[model samples]
Target: MGALAQLLPLVRSARRDQDQSVLSAALQAFLDFGIKRTSMVEVARRGGLSLATLYRRFSSKSDLIQAVGLQQTREFIEGVDAAVQQQIDRDAGAEAQIVELFVAFLDGLRGNRLLDRLLDTEPEIVLPYLTTKGAPVIELGRDYLAEFVTRLQAEGKLPAYDPLPVAEMVARTALSLALTPQTVIPLDDDIAVRKYARDHVAVSFRVPVTDS
Candidate 1:
């Protein structure tokens, strides 16, 4: 059998444990089956957990999904922040570093299939906190963008401008692009998505986009 087939039983056994392992299993099930197919009873059964115990841990499906979302969001923020710091420490060229960071950020976003499903199927779950709560995930992103802009501003690599508004615009723009990708009208193929991200950063810093 293939490696994945060989690992299936091991994966099941690992998930049978009653600790965070079970929760992880439940979350994975939800991601695989989606919200509509993933029910509380199914989650409990997959996790080898009792329905009562699942309820004790998570009062409802929404609560469990929220917990999973928050956990993934925190992890993503930390990973992206670390990647940014690493790129800065390497003293890579500004455009290259920005591209690397944005790609890493997009990888994180794509990995969170559950979050994507929530965005598509249940925007109500995330919209309120993303806007009104202005919680850690959003703030971390803003701070990262603001810092990148300020760095460029200090080095005179870009035009002088308030980073807050620019960061907000970039964040809002990115969010919109991610949540509602342009399907009706196709984007220009000359510039790929990664290039688009790099171009946005270059424009924000007022840097020329010519080959280095």
Candidate 2:
């Protein structure tokens, strides 16, 4: 199991009512004022706790940020899982399902107002969380996709290759498109973006054509 798969249970078990309130307040403050400007004192006040209590829960701003990011990542994974299941239920082919999975992931990111705002105005605050300390989230996503790919292989939809490497490629490609779409292709239209992913995924993972 990856680090994220291990941490998910811990994250679930560690959440108390007080901790939830603190994290909620801290996330709101960060969204409102950006990470650098959001102080622990303000978080405490917003959470209706004393500075000492807040500090006891989260020793510093970075700790609180990590907690918030982890929670968000957990939610994102859940949402993506649901979206992928829905697409599978639609009886789409394996390749189309993969494309839909990424489309749903992209849509989830686009729908998050706070994340979008941070990316727009305070990208610096968000970039490090994704680039420097983002292994947990990336691993979580990769593991989930790996499981999906394994299932596809069992259904004979994809070839019986190692799923982990392919899952990693899918995760990395999705993240790249989400973060730096302009570097890859124009994403001005949703249909075009989905087509692009579909084409790329098909070409990358398609079965070999052998002459009879």
Candidate 3:
């Protein structure tokens, strides 16, 4: 099928085999020491595998990082999908649903210890993945949100629009808030963040009101 469709099975297989452990070890090392400082030896030691095995599985450090990134992105998208579906099932209003979806996403990001460590100690390693070379993950997030928005439009819960552009706006806005929140806003406050997202984002997607 598609590239992502083809990659899912490999990711799932990695989760089932020693490759998962190796990737986990690499991720842990990268989070702790930054990718540049972390070596293949350290990854092998952390994974309890021989360097040969690590090399055999992944040709280089970049390959391992790419694999880890793909897996992480997949899991992140799955979590967002679940959160959005849960809100939809609750019969929440369109705005409320979007708010809850973003809240859930932000909560996940806040809870990720690896992300916190990377942000605090090695922001450079993470910046590229979010900015310059972030096409894969960004596309994943955009496509997922676009599909969700399309569903809402089909159900008459949101206005009909080109879901891709709208989803891109939503994804980029959410990513910005998650990564570098405005200094003036109390982004650390979950309640305030939810309110801000609802006030700002909901308007864009909400069905326009007309005088009866």
| Candidate-wise lDDT, in order | 0.61, 0.74, 0.73
Residue-wise C-alpha lDDT for candidate 1, range 1-212, written one tens digit per residue? 24323322333232334635556766788668766677889888887879999887666776565555445555676777787777565455567666666666665665667667767876776665455543434544666678877886676555677888777666665555556666432233423755776666556655555623
Ten-residue region with minimum lDDT total, candidate 3: 1-10
lDDT of 2 at 127: 80
Per-residue lDDT of 1-212 in model 3, one digit per residue for the tens? 24444444576433755877887888888877887799999999999989998888777776677677767766777877787776565465677777777777776666666666776777887777677766666777788788878877887778778989878887786667657755665558878977787677677776444301
* TM-score, structure 2 vs. true: 0.80
Best by lDDT: 2
lDDT of 2 by residue, 137-209 (tens): 6776788888887887777777888888877887777777667756655456678878886767655655333
- Model 1 has how many clashing residue pairs? 0
Global lDDT of model 3: 0.73
Number of residue pairs clashing in candidate 2, backbone atoms closer than 3 angstroms, sequence gap of 3 or more or interchain: 0
TM-score of each predicted structure versus truth? 0.58, 0.80, 0.79
The deviation in Å at residue 135 for candidate 1 is 5.3
Candidate 2 has which clashing residue pairs, if any? Answer: none
**C-alpha RMSD between model 2 and the true structure:** 4.0
